[model samples]
Target: MKRIPYMLLLASLLLNIYSAAVWGFACYAHSGVAERSTYYRQFTAGSDPRTFSVGAFTVTLLSLIVFIAAVRKLRGWYIAVAIVQALFALLYVWQLS
Candidate 1:
C-alpha cells in the first residue's frame, strides 16, 4: 500500500469534515447575529445552492485525485502537495465561515 495516497485521503477527509463543522456552527450562530446587514449575511440566509455545489465539487475532485494518486503509485511529493492543499483549503473554509 502506498503511503502518499492514504495521507492525501486523510488530509482531504479532514478538510471535508472541517468545512462541514464550520458551516454547521456558522448556521447555528447566525440566529443570534440575524440583524447584520452584510451581503455575505444575505447569501447565507438565502441558502445558496451554488455555494454548496462548489464546495462539494471541489472536495470530490480532491478525493478523486487522491484516489488516483494512491492507486497509480505516484510520487511522494505529489501526494504531499495534495495534503498541503487540503489543509490550506480547510483553513480557508474556517476563514470564510
Candidate 2:
C-alpha cells in the first residue's frame, strides 16, 4: 500500500525520460522522412509530439505532488526526484522549441 506512491513517482520519471527520448529521436535522428514519420506516429498514436509532451509533463507533475503529499518521511529522495523531474521538463521544452 505504501509503495504505491513510490511506484507512481518512478513511473512518472520513466515516462518523462521516454518522452524526451522520443522527441530527440524524432527531431535529431538522421532517418528518412517516411521512417521518422512512421516511428513518431506509432509512438504517439498519431498525436502531435507537443501534445504528447504536454501530457507527459502533466502526469509527472501530478505524480510528484501525490508522492510528496503521501510520503513525508523520504524528504531527500523526493527532493532529488523533483529536481530531476524539473530538469527533464526543461529538456522537453527545449527540444520542442
Candidate 3:
C-alpha cells in the first residue's frame, strides 16, 4: 500500500525518539556510577556519557523531524532509518547495562 512508507517513517520516528529518551535516562543514571569508579572515570575520561547521550538524543530528534518532513520523497530510505533506529535502541540498552 502507498501508506507503508509513511507508516514505516512514523515507526522510525517513534523508535528513535524512544531510544533517545532511554539513552537520556541512562546517561543520568550511569553518571554517578561512572564518577565513583576509578576504572569508569579513566575509561570515560574527557567524555561524559550523560553529555554524549544528550547530544545523541538531540541529533536523533532533529533527524526525525527532517525525515518526517521529507518522508514521501525519501521512500526506500525508510528501511535504512528503521535499521538505524534499531541500532540506536540496542546501543541505549547497552549503555544502561
TM-score of each: 0.43, 0.73, 0.40
Please give the RMSD of candidate 3 to the true structure.
9.7
Model 3 alpha-carbon drift over 4 Å, by segment = 1-45, 86-97
Model 1 clash number: 0
For model 2, how does the per-residue alpha-carbon lDDT over 1-97 read when each residue is reduced to its tens digit? 8898889989989888776677569768746766666677677779666677677777877887788789777667678888897777776566467
Higher-scoring candidate on lDDT, 2 or 3: 2
lDDT of 3 at 35: 41
lDDT of each: 0.57, 0.75, 0.54
Per-residue CA lDDT of model 3 for 1-97, tens digit only, reads 5565456556656645654564455456566654434333343444465554455555555555555565655457665774675567456546645
Tell me how many clashing residue pairs each candidate has. Answer: 0, 0, 0
Model 3 clash tally, residue pairs: 0
Writing each residue's lDDT as its tens digit, candidate 1 over 1-97 gives: 5686667566666655654565556566566444322333354455443465366547646765767755756568756755656565655555446
Off by over 4 Å in 1: 32-56, 68-97
